[model samples]
Target: MRTYFLLCLSIVLAANALSDNLVQAADPAFTHGVASGDPDRESVLLWTRLVSPDSPELELTWELAKDPTMQTILKTGTATARQEHDYCVKVIAADLEPGTTYYYRFRQGNIVSPTGRTRTLPRTAEHIRIGVANCAKYTGGYYHAYDALADTDDLDVIIHLGDYIYENGATRPGDSYYPSFLATGRQHNPPHTCVTLQDYRTRYAQYHQDPELLKLHARYPMIAIWDDHEIAKIPMQKSPSGEPIYDAAWQQRFNDSLQAWHEWIPCRAKQGEVIYRDFQLGSLVNLLMVDTRVCCKSKVDKTEASLKDPNRHIVGDEQLAWLKNSMLTHQATWNIMGNQLLFASKGSDWSRWPGFPTDRNQVIDFLTEHPRINFLITTGNAHNPHHYVVREKESSNILLHEVLPGSISSGNNTEKSRSNPAKLKKLIRAQESNPDLLWYNNDAHGFIVLDLTTQRALVEWYFVTDIRQKQYQVYRAHKLVIDVR
Candidate 1:
C-alpha cells in the first residue's frame, strides 16, 4: 500500500510539472488555427492568423503537401502577417490537380500552425456529398453539429449560408428565455454588442477558437456568405420610407465588417468586388452563391404598391444578370443556388424575397419556363428546417424545391413557439395557407447533408439531440429526394 501511494504521488507530480512547463511555454501565436476555403479545380485559398502581440509584423511560411505528414511538399511560399489585416494571412495555392486532397501548414520560427486539409473541385465526379449549415450563435449552444460534421469524412465540402457569427453580446447571467446555464459557456469576446470593426473581429476570433469549428475547417473546405448579423440587425441599408438609413458611421461600420469578413473568410474575391460567384463541380453541379444583403434595396412594407415596385430588387442587376446567364448556360445535372434569405412567400414577411415581388416573380417565371433545369435552392437564416416546393402561380406546377437547413447552434423555432403560443399558432396557419410547403419543423437544431448523383439529389436533415451538451447524437430528422435527371 505504501509503494502504491508513493507511485501515485510521483505520477501526479510529474504531470503537474509537465503541465506547468506547457503553460509557461504557451504563447499567443497562431491562436485561431488554420482554415482553407474557396476551392476551385486548380486552386484553393489558405488562411491563418499569427497572434504575435509583441510584433506588429511577422514573416510566415506556408506549405502545401500531398500527405498528412507534410514530407512531400507540393508548393511553398512566404506571406507577411501585418497588424492592419489583424495579422491574418491568406494565399492562393494554385496549379493543383482537380479532385485532389491537399494538406497545408503555416510556420514562423520554430512554431508551426495546425495542418488543414482541403480538396479542389473535381473535373468529373459521378457523385458528390455536401454539408450545409448556418446561423451559429456563440451564446446559443455547443457546436456539436460541427463536431459531427468533422467526423463525417464522406463530405466533399461545406456550404455555409449565413449568420456565421452573431453580433449579439453574451447571454445574460439569469435570463429565463435564454438561460446562461443552457448556453455552451462560450461568450462573445467583446462582452457587448458588436458595433465597431474591432468588435466584429473579436467576435470572429472567438468563434474561430471553438475546437469543433476549427476541426471542421481543418477537415473540409468551406464556402461561406454573411447575412445580417455580421453587420447589424435586420441589415437595412435604407429605411422603409426610401431614405438612406445607414449613416456615415454606419457605412463605416459596414465597410469595416466587409473588410474583416474578407480577411477572415477564405473567399476568392478581389477587394471592392462582390462575393457572388459560381462554382462548377464537374458536370454534376453548378453552385451559384449569391450576395443578397450588400446591394439590396430598402425593406419595404407589405403594401401592394411596395411589393409591386419595379425598382425593388433582392439580388442587384449585375448579380441577377450573372445568375440568369449561369442558369441558362449551365449543363450540369444540378443547379444549386446557395442563398441567404428564405425564398418562400411569407405573407407579411417583408424581409425575404417575397418583399420584392417583381424580382421574385421573374425568378419563378424563369424556373417555370425552364422545366428541364433541376433547380435546388438551399437557404439559411430561418433557424428551423423548412422543405417547400416552389410552384407556378397560374398552373400550380412545381418549379423547384427549396430546402432550409436548420441553424447550427441558434435557438430553434420550437423554443420561441413555446414561449409564444399565439405566434406558433400563426406559423401553423401560415404553413396551412401555403400548399407548396411540404414539411416544416421549428424545434430542431442541426444541418443538412446533400448527396447528389446523376439521377437524383437526396437531402437529409440531421438534428443534434442536445446543443447544451458536448456529447450528443445526430438523428436523421428528415430526408427528401428530388429527381434531378
Candidate 2:
C-alpha cells in the first residue's frame, strides 16, 4: 500500500508540472473567443478563433454537455486551428437529443473557456419562440439589441438575415466612426479595408471578437444568410465587380471568402453553395434560407432608364423557382422565408425582390395561387427594423407578412436621403394606423424575437440603446402577430 501511494503521488506531481508548463506558455489570444450556430434537432456547429501575435497553427479540444454547468459530458472531440484556415475552428457535433439544452466549451493549451449553452430544436410543436436580426457593425456602438435579446426568455432560434460584416475601404480619413469605431475601442483587424480572401477572413475574425456577439451566438442556434456586405458592398451581378471579374481569380476569391465564411459560421454548404436551404422546427414551422446574391445578370447602373430595366434579377431565376416550390410544398403549419434584402419596396437600388420585378411578381403570384400558405418573411440589410404587408397586384388582401429585423450594431447609412428621421417617425406612428405599412424603427439598433404555433406567428422587436458606447442597453420595442387561416 505504501509503494502504491508513492507511485500515485509521483504521477499527480508530473501531471501538475505539465499543466503548469502549459499555463506558462499560454498565449493571450482567443480575441474572437467561441460561438455555436446552425443548430438542428440533434446537432450544432461550434466555432472559435485563436488570434496569435501573428497567425499561427494551434490545437484545441471541445466538449458538449447535457447540463449548462457542463458537469455531465455527452461527447467531446479534438480539432486544430491552423494558420492556413485563419485559426478559426468550426466543428459540427451530431447525435444530440431533440428539444434539449447542451453546454459547450473549448480548451487551449492550459486555459478553459467560459461555458456556452445551446438548445436543440424541439421535436414537436408544443410551441417554439425564435429571434431574428442582421447587419451589425461593431463601430456603430454597443450591441444593445444583443444584450436585450440575450436577456429574453424562451428563445428557440435566432435567425440572422445577413450583412454580418462590412468590407468597405478605409472610411476616408477623419471619417471617425465610419472607419474605426470609438466604442469597440479600436478599428477592424487587418485594419485596412478588405478586398481579398485574407481581408475578408480577418474582418470576420475582428467582428466575432465582440463580447456581445459572442454572448448572443453562445446562447441560441442561429439561422443565417448573407447579403452584399458579407462579401463586398452590393456585389450585384457585375456591378462593382471585383478585379479580374471573369477570370478564375475573382471566382476563386469569391469561393475562398465563402469557404472561410462557412468555416467560421455554423451554416452548412450544399454543393459548394450557401444559397437556398430549408429547416424545420418540429411540426410548427419551416424556415427557407435563400441566397439572393449569385447567378443574376448584373444590375444596370442606377440610371433613370435602368431603374425600369424589367430584366434586373435579385433572387435569380433558379433561386426564385426554388423559393416558390418550397413555399408551395412546405409541410409545416407556418412557412417562414429567411430572405436577406427588402421585398416591399422593389425596383429601388436596395436590390431585393423589387429589383427583380419578374421574380417578385412570380412570388406574389405564387402567394395568391396558394391562399392556404401562411407565409412570413424575415429579412435584414436595411440596418433598421421594418414591417410590411405583401399584397397581390389587384387585391388589398394581405397575401404575406414580412418582418425586417434590423441590425444588432449597424445603423442606417442613407438616413438623410432615402430614410430620414421624419419618415422614420411617421412609419413608427403608422404601426397602428397603417395596415399595409405596419411599423418601422429606424433610429435604434437591435434584433427581433419570434414565437410560432399552428395558429399564429408572433415577432417581438428588441432595440439597442447605443452601439457607440461600451455599455449596451436593450429594450423590447415592438411586437406583431399573424394569425394563420
Candidate 1: give its CA RMSD in angstroms.
Answer: 7.1
TM for every model, in the order presented, reads: 0.91, 0.83
Q: How many clashes in candidate 2?
A: 7
The best candidate in terms of TM-score: 1
Q: Give each prediction's root-mean-square deviation over alpha carbons.
A: 7.1, 8.2
Candidate 2 lDDT: 0.68
**Model 2: runs farther than 4 Å from truth?**
1-31, 50-59, 169-186, 238-253, 295-298, 301-312, 346-350, 413-435
lDDT of 1 by residue, 1-485 (tens): 11211111122112222322322344547777678888999999999888777778999999998777688998999999998998889998999999888889888988777777788999998888889989988787888888777666567789899899888876774542265235456666798888888998988877877777877788889998878888777565555444667679887888888788887887878557888988888889999998878765566666777777677777856677888799788778898999988787666668688777777877887777777888899999889999988777887777789999888887776665665789888888888788878998877888999999999999999888988877799889889998864
Clashing pairs in 1: 414-442
Model 2's C-alpha root-mean-square deviation from the true structure amounts to 8.2
Write the residue-wise lDDT of candidate 2 on 252-333 in tens digits.
6667667667767777664266457787788778888877765454554566566466555666567777777776665678
- Candidate 1 lDDT (Cα, whole model)? 0.80
